[model samples]
Target: MEKSNQLFNQEQQIIHRLLLNAPFIPSVGLLTGQVGIALAFYTYYRHTECAVYGDFAGELLDNALESLDKSIDIAFSNGLTGIGWGIEYLILKGFVDGCGVEICENIDQKIMESDPRRISDLSLEQGLEGLIHYVLIHISASIKQNVRLPFDSLYLKDLYTVVKQACQEDIPDSFRSLAEIYMDFIEKQEPIDYPLHLFSFIDIVHLDTDKLTDYPLGIKDGLAGLLLKEITNE
Candidate 1:
């Protein structure tokens, strides 16, 4: 066996051992939702330019991404629709270390401000899944529009810039007016009645955060955003 193969085998063995004993280990970052640690490993993968290091770091990157993806999949399967609170919990537990009180509070504020449930004072969010199914039939009938409501908490707040840009030309002014009305109805501090345009709402809530901030976290917004983009295209 050559030196490189021997080293590979050794490292692989160590990884297997760590994975088997992961629950007992204190620093298995993915298990604990410490994505910063995962990102650190990813940096090593991307920046490893050493001739001697070769494919080792690349392999590690694959594992890191796969591990993170699996964790996401497992969480999704077990009803992890939104990761906002989880991230905040990380911040509080000092897992998101170094971001102090002010930054954490800002992050917390952003999360609460954007959620439709928060903005609507829990009114709009109630029966959201059932509401989607019920209204899909009628809206599709009256306007012939096939509505794909944004994912849980994927709000217009998340896609604020998208809305603002879409409303810039105001071909009929309805789009812009609709945007304003929705904002006014769902005022963060004091929500009024449920907006007539309910599907315009989202759980992840419409994604104005596309440019405003980083609420949906990474590609956390996922493919549901494709529908949002397509609608904005009109």
Candidate 2:
């Protein structure tokens, strides 16, 4: 826990530095959210199923560096202007270490600010990184893959429904105003996904932790109760 907190702080500092040096280019930085979602998924998967999550983080950090190289190559091939890859390795580190959602939303905001015509255009070629695309393609993927909302929190049910509806609905100004709704939904939904390993480390919440200690922890018993309660309410 101490180590994770330390790493989290370090990532925050790194992301701050990169944001300071970040360029004001358009459309190119959209991949930041996509990459963040991938990282979040992997993070949860590590805690739940993988024994080598730490090693995986190290390897992924290295891959983020390599991804910068690829981004540069992509930028050079296309006519996109600004930094070789507007998305930086430090930002990627922050995302993997638990800062991705915030960072991605920040980037998505940049996308919206850069192109105001996207809502009317509704064309990808027109550079529509507004709220809806951000929510559905980038943000939702991260929340669903990493946070395990449906698995944990009830408030998350309403939150996801709202965002999912915004993405699926044909609202005017979805790029700007509609996107705001999506952001609000995400903000409310975060608590559901947060404390990534909160329940997993407890016998009452996650029995696996107790199982490791050879204690008779009724992890499933509690989960069954919770599940029953949820079903009954439905």
Backbone clash total for model 1 is 22
Candidate 2 — what's its lDDT?
0.32
Candidate 2 stretches greater than 4 Å from native: 1-37, 40-44, 47-49, 65-113, 118-130, 133-234
| Candidate 1 structure quality by residue, lDDT tens digits, 131-173 | 2222222222222223222222344344443444444553334
Cα lDDT of all candidates, in order?
Answer: 0.30, 0.32
For candidate 2, write residues 1-234 as lDDT tens digits: 345534334223333322232222221222332222223324433434644433443443344434442233221112111111212222333433443344334333333333232133342223332223333433344554474222123333443454454456564552445355445656664322111221221223332322332322111223222221232344
Superposition error at 219 for model 1 (Å)? 21
Q: How many residue pairs clash in each candidate?
A: 22, 1
